[model samples]
Target chain A: MRVLCCVKRVPAPGAKINITADGQDVDTAHLGFAMSPHEECAVEEAVQLCERFDGEATVLTLGPPEAEEQLRYAASLGVQKAVLLSTDGSSWDPQRTASAIASAIETLEAADGPFDLILFGNESADSGGYQVGIRAAHALGRPIVNAIKGIEPDLDAGTATAKREIDGGFELYNLPMPAVMGVKEGLNLPRYPTMRGRLASKKIEVSVMQAEADEGGQTRVTLKQPAETVSNTVKLGNGPEAAPAIVDLFEELGLL
Target chain B: MADILVLAETEDGAVVPATLEALTAARQLDGDVHVLLCGDSVDADDAAERLGEYGASTVHVGESDLLNVFGPEAWGQALALAIEEISPDVVLASGTSKGNEVLAMAAARLDLPFVANCTELPSELADDDEVELTRVQWGGSLLEQSQLSAETRIVSIAHHALEAESAGGSAAATETIDMEIDDLYARTQVVGREMAEAGVTLATAPIVFGGGRAVGSAEAFAPLEECASLMGGRVGCSRAVTNNGWRPHRDQVGQTGTRIAPELYVASGISGAIQHWVGAMASKQILAINTDPEANMVVKADYFVEGDLHQVIPAVAEEIKKRKA
Candidate 1:
């Protein structure tokens, strides 16, 4: 069955992030970009499903024109097609973002047959709104499940068995076909692209579509740098010789 | 005052602390707070007693077989019915796991905007239907100030953001709402579970001993684990350790992983990346053991021991053992 995976280009996760001077956005002067870890796994899962089911994998992303770079990366790993929902570099509120994506999916399906499975990262690594996938699912009138860690497609039954992580174990959901899922990062270990694959990715043409996002009900006022927390760490000696001191430290905290 | 609706998450026979925290937040949005309690065979009196402590103006209890099993679709449907009848101006819940899913489901059912992981309440300066708020982005690493305008605002309160407090009042009115549970909603019910051993889990651990990429190997975690067990805590790791195949992803503590708030977080070999700091910053006390004193984790920690974790871990464990003996 054909699969569609949604990916987002986010600042590489790590280090303290600085807000831009305007306070309306993140300062990305020294930052690099990568697909969110969760979406990376979603792309990998979509590719794997295509490999097993003898279908094509289409990767879509909503970001600036530079997002084509992420689309190409996905193409390098065997994605058959790449679509860029190109927009202004500014972020969209979840309400508008979800509708824009739903519209794009409908436009794609009008030409191509419907996708059997659509995947989204559980949440964006940057904004982390945790609403777009569910909102899109609702807008498209499809059954959607979120926080999926494991998935088993029942081709015979025309259903998808999705497992979401809970506190102790997992909660399983049997969703009908043409389903949507919000997958987490640990769903799979993404495979690296080979030299030949990278070369093929360079030649793949990216289909760019302008995403006319409506001004939704939500608006970002400004970004605030979180208050810095200072910790005055008392050095408890050094090396293994400090082990006894460490024990004393634990005792002082009553953690013994 | 606007009428606020809170999805009360219950545990055992009482309400979860997070729900109380949600009620605490709801009280601020408006004093007219209503709570929707959904579950099977829920002890209404017990829940109402606890909820009343947090200034719940009304508790709407929805009991049904569909809610007997844990599923967001059915729960959200039930909550939707309650919302329609209660007609509250805003809906609130906690930000992780069940609370996140159920509110998202309800948002979809109603086709409304649902904001998740809110860290701060909005300013009352703009007196209108629209509310100005600040929410967590990058799992608390960054905060985004936003303005949300809707007939009904649905929000999922971020964990550890608001402290749960009681208004110190008696129980308010309790209303039993009629629930219409459909088979379609219950169609995707949970078939099974894999419950972990009782106690000492990362979320509720009193102390947490964590390692990072510098810890070297999976076997290297043995000493840290021993130290954690001795201290009645759990052993956690950074995403780097899981990436290096030295530890499982479940042991990771970061924005993308578990947000841990323990009595103390004793971390070694970790550089205290922003993502990890977001999760570990909630700890009451933090201690870092790293060779580089200038490391991010060391600089942020409340206590430090500059050394190789491989040598320091076992020595500390041995010292604890010796002291106990």
Candidate 2:
């Protein structure tokens, strides 16, 4: 089995994000970056699946050149290869990103072999669009599942069972091969890179693909800052006295 | 005449709350409301009755063997087929994981413009129908309004963004439509299903007890669990807590995990990042407990306690116990 896990480098979840002074996009100069938390599970699942199924795991990313840092990180986690769709970091629209990723996957298939499985995080931690994986699956004409919490791959039967999170709990699903699966967090705890693994990863080569515009550049009418609500700060005591005040506050807020 | 198509999500043979909310929003339009139901032997009589009550004049049932196991491609194809059959003016679905995925593919395959997590309706509907929509941006701190041009409007409504209300009426007449099953395309099969750890879902919990990096360790989260249990609620965590392996990802409350709308949300040791706030901001009352007087959570909180979580949590738990006693 050949597994392809799509990874994205996003701003760290805890960072206080601010739109640049230009008011067009997020200010990235001071923000730290890492693999999207959900995508980490995808990469981890891909590595585990390959380990169990006796196959190779290839990590793919579509972003600016800095995204290569995440690809290298995936390599450090024992991913056999890394593919980067390096763009100029301007167009991060979901549809355009999906199209570019689909093209990159097609190129890889033409060079290597058809991938048996593709994995993606449910959504990017930064943009949280939650559309690219399914759109890519559609563009590639493949089956897909989103927000999968658990996966059971059956190599002999050439089918996979996935448990997806629904409104309440989850529903069981079975899908066939050459499918796309979007992994949510808690699917598996991603492993940290070992010293030996990191040394080996430093020697791995990364393939960078040229950027191309998606079908017809999807129009981005305007990018503006969202409205901010005023912060209402209230302080309370730490003991039993706080409870009534809390209740009174809830009553005032119409929460009780 | 233009018709709006709403995809009604069903779980375990029951219609989901968000689906009703979507149908309610769909009724605001001046076109016929058409609903699509997919499942293995969906009780069309019951579903159509509910859809009709929610203002759907026509319920289109797409029955397939593959419906038992959700095949995104197959479902998208089925929906695309339904769209062709109905020629809808708009296609709407709840922004649940599955709803967003299937509709995105359906929109992409049809080459139609699409938007996600829409909080408000577009200001205008014209030939181009470039609708302006509000979506949570900058980690829920800001709502960005943008426009999209498409002949057929496609959008996914953010769950909990709208309230769910029943439309009082008898069940509409049932109609069954046999959808073509592409077993070849449906290569994936569901082998089985397993439940997550037993607890009230954070999204629906009335009171959410949450922790952050300040909790220190997984063991320290025991107090939160106790508080949640005492309140008959559920426990939630910020991304930092989950990242540190202090809690399972399912318990994470944020943009990437599960957006929650609780009556009272209590944050312990959390510094309130924008993404985290965006998820829980819908809560009616927010209480933040942290030693840091200037924590972002303290600033946003309705009630702030400037004390160590280690001290505040046990004290609060004891107080709840005393109150119950």
Candidate 3:
């Protein structure tokens, strides 16, 4: 099985996210970068699938040179190959990003055969457009599903079974091979890279290809931090003393 | 007035509350609201009647075997066809998983632009081809003022961004659309479903008791469970707790887990990282119990109690039981 997983580099924000003075980007001076949480799980899933099927797992990202860091991180997690769809480090709209990634996939598939499966984060941690994977799948003429938390690919049968999480339970879907899925975070518990794996990842040569696509109709005017939720926090009491007050407040809210 | 189309979703043969929220948002755009209700799971006639009361002037019902179950491509194709027939200036849907998926598919099929999780739209959106709007980023931690330059604007209203209220309008006229289902539409049809045991879910519970890593071990969640059970609520956890294997992912309250809107969220020992904050921000009230006074949850919550949850939670649970007696 040949699987490709798409990842994005986003700031790993802690308590709060601060914007740049221009409001065009996030302030990264004191921040660390990590792969989007869902895509990290996708990478883990692809690696496990390859391990089970004895195949290759490739990780790709569409971002600037710094995004190579994310691709290398994927390599450390057992991805055998890495590709960088190099961009100018500017944010692209969902349509443009999808178009560029689809084109990149086409170029890569031309060299090697088509990937049996392609996985993407259900949504990016930052922009959260919720469309890039679907649009890219449409462009590749592949069937796609979103919010998938489980996948079982049958190579001999050329089919893949996927499970999507709903409010109370899950819905299962079956798709032909060469399918796509927007995976959610709980697909798997991502494994941390071993010391040996990290050393090996440094030697994995990332293929950098310049991304080409026209800007889509959606444009970002600026970014603004949401107004902080103003709360006149009422301190009820300390320790066990707070319990009676909590019950009283619960009664006030009609929870009793 | 501009012609606006809303893709309505249904559950248990009635309109979903989020769709009504979308309709309320649509009314703000100053348009004649038309609804597209598709699927056998929904009673199209009943949905039309309810949607009409929400200011929907027309309801276009489409039914097909492929649409009997949730299939993204089928719904997307149906929406694309409906758009062609209605020729609306704007299209809206609830920012649900299915809602966003279908709209994305439709946008791809038609090669148009679509935006998701919009919290606000400019009042002059109907008149302008290129309009600026505010949408949530980082799961509502940040907001983006975006520009959409599309002939037919397609967007989804953020969940719970607007209250769902009826406009008390006239009954809507019904129109039926022929859903042309093809073999490809069934490629990803939902073939099986598994339901969780009936109880208050984290997303729907009136009160949620959330524990963090400070709860220590898996066994430490017992008091939280007891409190939730006594209060007729549900127990949730932060990502840290889930990552530590103290709870399941389904019980996690955070950006990647579940976004809840409980009336009261009792956050115990959770520090309220941006990821967890986004999920719990919609709660009507929050009571934070933590040892640190400067903890994010404590600072942001409506009420705070400074203490170790180990002692505080059991006491709270005991108090609830005493009150019941």
Per-residue accuracy of model 3 over B6-103 as CA lDDT, tens digit each: 99876656788889899889998888889988866876667777899998999998867888777898889889999998989999999999899999
* Candidate 1: tens digits of C-alpha lDDT, residues A50-158: 9999989999999999999999999999999999999988879887888899999999999998999999999998898887888888788787778898889999999
Using TM-score as the yardstick, the better of models 1 and 2 is 1
Q: Candidate 1 vs candidate 3: which has greater lDDT?
A: 3
Best by TM-score: 3
Query: For model 3, what is the error of residue B156's alpha carbon versus the real structure, in angstroms, after optimal superposition?
Result: 1.0
Q: What is the per-residue lDDT of model 2 for residues B1-325, given as tens digits with 9 covering 90 to 100?
A: 5688888777667777789988877766676778888765458888888888888888888878776556666777778878887778789988877688778878877877677777755535312466677765544554556566677878887777788666675666655568886776555444456666766788888889999888899999998899888877789999778878888888899876778888889998889887688888888878898888788788878778777878777767776676557
Q: How does model 2 fare in lDDT?
A: 0.78
- Cα lDDT tens digits, model 3, A1-256, are 9999999999999999999999999999999999998998899999999999999999999999999999989999899999999989998999999999999999999999999999999999999999999999999999999999989988889999999999899999999989999999888878889998898799999999999999999999999988888888999999988899999989999999
- Per-residue lDDT of model 1, residues B1-325, tens digit only: 6778899876445677899888888877644889998865467887788888898978888878777666667887888888788877888898866788788888778877777888866635113568877889888878988888878788888977889998996986788877888877665667666566777678779899999888888987899989988888999988778767677667889876778989889899999997788778889888899999999888888889889999989998889989999
**Reference contact recovery of candidate 3:** 0.85
For every prediction, compared with the true complex, DockQ reads 0.65, 0.46, 0.83
RMSD in order of candidates: 2.1, 3.0, 1.3
Each candidate's iRMS in angstroms?
1.6, 3.4, 1.0
Off by over 4 Å in 1: B11-14, B39-41, B123-127
Candidate 3 residue B138 C-alpha distance from true site, Å: 0.6
